[model samples]
Target: MANSDNNNKTAWQMATQVIHAGSGHDDPHGALAAPLYQTSTFKFANTEQGSARFAGEEGGYIYSRLGNPTTHELETRVAVLEGYDAAAATATGMGAIAATTMAFVKAGDHIVVSDAIYGCSFALFSELFERFGVHADFVDLTDADALTTALKDNTRLVFLESPANPHLKLVDIEAVSQILAGRDIKLIVDNTFMTPLLQQPKQLGADLVIHSATKFLNGHGDVVAGIVCGSADDIALIKGTTLKDMGATISPHDAWLILRGLKTLDVRMQRHCENAEKVADFLHKHSLVRKVYYPGLAEHPNHSLIGTQMRHAGAVIAFELDGDEAQSRYFLNQLQMIPLAVSLGDAETLIQHPASMTHSPYTPEARQKAGISDTLVRIAVGLEAAQDIIADLSQALQSSQQRWQRSA
Candidate 1:
């Protein structure tokens, strides 16, 4: 596969970009779908060509680990969609995070991370990086004053997620970018929850934008991959350093699946947003639900950022049960349709308890400080009919509340 001239045009809308971007169908047969080059290594035309490729005097791929046509196409499509100069696909969401961080930061450098982020990400910064002498401060990035106060001369990077994981708390990306402006500190955003359809962090002044392609990008739960988009220079630095050395490259097959998944992303995301809003509304009005954390609700603390920061309130929703952890477990068990799973952005609705599942990497004190409550439940609303999902929730909540009453 080769780059398509059509993909470079900025005028193409996102829907078209998702389908046609990075696809020239330039294979020998001119296949409408991009061909997957699954081989581990590419044969050189000759010894001279192979040496030239290794010496950077040539342009074609020499190794799949270094780069694959299939993965390259995925990277290009994502880069164009994200409005970045370049991109790199990784084996997992954590691989993307690790490559991006390791490419830029060194030992003794300081990083400021959102107090609320994905559970494994918290562990990566707090544990893995700490052993390397990289210090991280988990700060409330939603607080502009706190963000400003937390930055030090040694601060090399600031990382956060908008509509953050498990809790759905939001960070003001533009404001945080401005605070770090001219300071030479890189601002990295994990855009997994929003997807490029709902938000473009680069448009907001972020230096790099990353996604767990495993989630909404794949839309189906079958694949696990990730991508990072940034300026060509930054992406090159990453590709040359940690991504190349650590070798967490995405497989060609997974890249192809993500490409297949991308074609339906626009429609899937619209459905997800619609379904999530309906579910959030239902949860908000339920007597058994203590509080809803969806930004789509008018009363949500970060609802004001919707139009300016993100196109819509995304698919994931987090809420507190009007009961204890045991009651929360009872409600989860009573549910008949939604599966109790960790990952989101699938065809079927999925739910999880962050404190006990995803965010368990944090200690009890850290989890409390991060606002991941014991009774909080997160759901990735699926493509099912809105009424059906709500009915399922209603029955489960009613049953759990009745059981709690009986036990009480």
Candidate 2:
């Protein structure tokens, strides 16, 4: 279904779009739910029709790998939500990053990346892509001068994640976009942390926006999917090349799950924001907490960018303990409610140590440079009652302090 014509014309708000952006989907049974096209291939009426589809002269799908109605619906819904011309869904968040970057970069190309990023992303740029001859410069995007200095004549992309993973360091998107404005270099933003509900990077001059739909987009932590939104021509190129050849296509079932999850995205995001704000305030006031890194805090370094870059500080919070690594580990173990795990934006609150877990791919020196301390803990606040979450954290903190004090 997705009535492309109507979606293009109507300027639906976020709440409306999340539920019905891909409405007008044609269903033979006229089911209330979007039809899940779960097959691996599609049937063509005739040889001529198949030839036309293969030759790009016709519009129907020939193979699920190449295209699927359910996946396309997810793409359309996300594209409309992000205010982009088109979008492509990938098997994983890393797939979206790889496909989008590989579709554009060549052997001799260079990319500038934010100093602080997801562990796998860092490994992709520093370890994998480097072997293939593409190089990247990891710099603190917060410093405009550093970004300016890092740009090269062969720079093809400037990649960054605002409110970056594990640390909550924010970059000025509009400023970075302006820096790359007249250049051929494209600005790619990982909007996984702040979903379209909180921030839309494309609206602020980014050429392409990427999301780990597995996180906030699905909001259920059930599907591991990714999305990249950009101009139609760019999406077509990505679809025709990297996605098609690299084989990182998403499953129809996963796409369908995401579509279902999108229905409650508005409410989920609102609750996430509200819960995170309260949790952050509690942590900031707690004596056992060292440094709290959440944009919601007025004292945060990037607090000024809150209204301009993002609607709110978002659901993830990164903070360090007053003690060292042992205390951090003990505190995480002492938590009874919040699960110690990786991945964010889930309905259940999750916490993890970045240095040894998510950002383990980075060397100690690299982590230090990126501002990921050994004791830093990241918490993805969930829909749990604020008071309950606070009480759990409070007990864990108190217990951690007492145990560490006794050992000392």
lDDT of 1: 0.91
Worst 10 residues of 1 by lDDT: 1-10
Judged by whole-model lDDT over C-alpha atoms, candidate 2 comes out at 0.91
* Model 2, span 166-215: residue lDDT tens: 89999999999989989999999999998887788987899999999999
Residue pairs with clashing backbones, model 2: 1-25
lDDT of 1 by residue, 1-408 (tens): 002333223323888899988885469886888898989999998999999999999899999989999999999999999999899999999999999998889998999999999999999999999999999999999899999999999999999999898888888899999999999899999999998888889989999999999999899899999999999999999998899999999999999999999999988988998899889989999888889999889888888888778888899999999889988988998989999999999999999888999999999999999889999999999999999999899999889878988998
Each prediction's TM-score versus the true structure: 0.96, 0.96
Which regions of candidate 1 deviate over 4 angstroms? 1-12
Task: Name the TM-score of candidate 2.
Answer: 0.96
**Weakest ten-residue segment in model 2 by summed lDDT:** 1-10
Q: List the residue pairs that clash in candidate 1.
A: none
